[model samples]
Target: MRRQTQECKEYMEAGEKYLDCQDRQLTSVMQDWPKDINHLLLARNKIQVLRDNMFSQFTQLKSLDLQQNDISMVEDGAFSGLSQLTTLLLQHNRLKTASEEVLLPLPRLTYLRLYDNPWSCQCSLDSLVRSLQLPSNRNLGNYAKCAEPLLVVGQKLKKLSVDSLCRDDNQVDRGTGGGDGGRPRLPLIKVKPEATSMCHTYVFPKLLLDCSNKDLDHIPSDLPSDIVKMDLSSNIVKHLRPKQFLLSKDLKLLNLSGNSLRHIDTAAFAGLLYLRELDLSNNSLHYFQYGVLEDLYFLRKLSLGNNPWVCDYNIHYLIYWLKHHPGVSYTGLMCSEPQEFRGWRVEDYVKTYNGECPKDRQTGGMDTGQGGQGGSDNEAQEVAGETGEQLPRPLREKKRNRFEIIRLS
Candidate 1:
């Protein structure tokens, strides 16, 4: 049995010239080291540590993989021996810090992957991102962020604007009371002197314009001609210009959820003959004319939940649309009816209050939508609570205004 086991091990090592240690339950040292090995994959091992000279014998190795490990640290010069190595994968690791000191030795490494790692967003990380963006720098841009306070989880590094991603850090720290000596820690805005993407345009792909708490007071005028999906979720827009909405030919999805939008042009969405989903939730709209949303023939998913809806005769028109539009979904929106008539549904609303609105009550601009401020981590908690509920007042206030489609020219 002992000889058979030894033979099995020998055959396992000799059976193939390349070894894939990825996702292997490798917790300890292996018994035999194979020669002439060119590729070594040790990813997803759940390894926390690497011993000295782990791969010293594989002198001909060209590619190495080590992803999805619990690796928080690397012993000094752990990979100093791989002279001909070109590709290295170290993504989804628990590395809090990785620097040139650990990587300056690899001469031939051209492609390296270190994305999806839990890198703490602090000044320490500043040096990392900057160095990575440098065209001449080595293996710096390979790493991606694991947790950003704003963007989706595990997003690619090259896709997101670093300025926007880093902006939330200072604001996040300020709310934690990390202030020194009683000084208020104002959030730091990420400044990108050169903010531009490689114009990889797809004819009006979905516009992921998440300008929540940005310095933009207006919209960029040069919207793509085939913008089928538009997301203006959080910005300080006061109004939608005629060119902003009316000119787009194939706008299918429109989201004006959180802005300062008080009113929309009755003809604001003239050219959007193919609009399907329209979200106007959490705005400063006290009244909406029926003609505003009438042209949306393809509009199926309509959201108007959090606006300070003054359940009046005008609401009857919107309710009439909702009652007929089977695809329309009104998620968790509420109305403050007169003292006696509260908690109204869309079906009954048009029946009893069609062309009928509450006139006597003097309407004041109530909390924009719900109590929510910008740049506060607590505001994130508040938004979490309103996920399917009313739109946060702060986000609503930013959407009311529009710009001349400001281009980055």
Candidate 2:
């Protein structure tokens, strides 16, 4: 009989290990994979249903890519043991309905891509919708719309009210986390003295804690966990430490505009998986450090106007990130440094950064003219110097794995 399954092996990227099974027409995961794999790529496959405990062995898995598949149903315990999973991609599938229980095992999930799926917004989907609509989960289910039920068809799943989905009004009311409700409530934290004394707390019309113009150079300790919005604009805070907002997991909007902010740590926004709107306008930031924006997986709107943005390869990371995330709308990214590129748009400058040299300079190999002999090398070095880095090598080239079997002579 022809072989229908292959041994699960390893793949390498940037010196890290992962399992790559992309573009394979398989229906299920192959057996004998290492239990310690941190990344798994299974895109472009024919896998339909996810049975229970399908990935229970990979306890150390951190990211799982299941995009571009025919997956329609996921059993409740399919991901039962993936407690360390932080990123899950289930987009471009045939999932019509799912329960919050399916996601209970992924407590640390930071980036979830559920868009491009045909979601059915009916009574059975109320629980999932309610969970996504919570203030702490604002970044979870994005761009997911209903495909069934004519009345709610095409409506976003995050905005659909639970009362309208179910016929029983009392059940819907209880589901809203009222007294004796099924959903657990977030623990109430006592507002610290420093926070209460400096910030103005407002609960009506939405919970907003305004700490703007506080004339403070540091953030207050023990911020209220239930606040949905915070205003810390026009402050003198210059540096952001790592995990500064770790306790503010429920924040959906934050304004740090008009501050003297010049440096931001890479993990300054960690544990803020649900933050959607951020304002950093009128700051002194020239460029962001690599991976500074890594934790903001769901940010939708950013205000970067009036910042002194420099035109260099160091600034390209921000533009590259924005290009990949077209959902995020930003403003004021004109180059203000390196006089020659001043007044130029950041995107236009990035295009010129990759421009090639003239053909004449490249073809001056044997000519005894002014640009002969070592002209190409000089020009290449000049180009590299201008870009602040050398050319990148191809990292995605595919190579066939070789295997050898030995027998006793």
Candidate 3:
């Protein structure tokens, strides 16, 4: 017992308590365990049977890993008090049967793994099969197959008909076929490609998804709705189609930096109402079209660095929207456009849009001398005022003649 205890590793991760007792050859859970642990792992053990009240002490446990064990039978009350348990893994075990009543104590169970087990397909396993096939239990017992009754061997338990398990003819209505209960067959669900198989998924510390550096040319379909943060940076996504992120309504932080993004449809972010931080840096973006950012009402920070932002009339909308939303802190919006305005701040370029100068103090008239030098002086003064600095006279002269057209005599 002392050697087994020494093999177990108990530690705190991100302020959550965890106890890992995997590969300790534990036949049963030890009594010397902290009651406040949030995660408990007991995989690759020699556990055969689960007695009544097997884990009643760990009331606060959120996840239990018991895969690759010798567990064959589980008493009905084995998980009696695990009210907060959300994840349970029982795959690769030696079990042939399990009653649905054994899961009654796990009220919050959302993720259940029961695959790779020798499941018996008989009258006794009817209730468990029916429970696992419920539409609401789609994530439970996935990939589990029936191993007994040669007629239905290797059949997926989730797609198995409940009528085939029980022998009573009055229980289920018969279909066109013969010997079996003849229940109407359910069509197999079409498997859609998902990014979860390729990317890393983290459940604790805030449900994060990392799909960066995947060489993706488009956003992956069917993103999880509960993810709070997603990183899709350093890819080849060039266009953001309409309603691209409509599924991930709970997203708070989105990192799309270091991509080849050039165009974003107006409704590309239609459902991102709660987005707090967005990173669009190091891309090939030019400007945002009107109404493209209409949905980000609660945005806090925006990163637009290292992009070739054109300082044209089309770029005015971005500055206009940011001005109205004073709460959003932004960076790196310099002009990389028409040679005259190259390297100018986007805010300063937008200020010169009106082209109206104030009346002179001494002459009481608009100073319209030398190729709209008056307007140039006003633009320079406004830029200086915004940054709390004075513009050099040479730079001001250079800007004054930028639009002047000389006629050959």
TM-score of each: 0.37, 0.43, 0.60
- Estimate the overall C-alpha local distance difference test score of candidate 2: 0.76
lDDT of 3 by residue, 272-340 (tens): 999999999999999998999899999999999999999889998999899999999999999999889
- Cα lDDT tens digits, model 1, 26-64, are 764365746556766665577887655666677677777
What lDDT does each candidate get? 0.57, 0.76, 0.80
Q: Pick the candidate with the highest lDDT.
A: 3
CA deviation > 4 Å runs, candidate 3: 1-35, 40-59, 64-83, 88-105, 110-192, 357-409
Provide the lDDT at 320 for model 3. Answer: 89
List, residue by residue over 1-409, the lDDT tens digit for candidate 2: 1122253447555554677667878788766767777888787789999999999999998888887789999998999899999878787789999998999999998767676677878877888899888888866775667776545655778788788887752442343455764585334344223433455554323567788998868876546566789999998999988987888899999999999999998888888888899999999999888888887889999999999999999998898889988999999999999999999998899989866655533323322232223554465455447555443213435453364221111
Where does candidate 2 clash, by residue pair? none
Scored by TM-score, the top model is 3
Lowest summed lDDT across 10 adjacent residues in model 2 is found at 400-409
lDDT computed for candidate 3? 0.80
- Clash count, one per candidate: 30, 0, 0
Q: Considering lDDT, which of the candidate structures 2 and 3 is the better prediction for this target?
A: 3
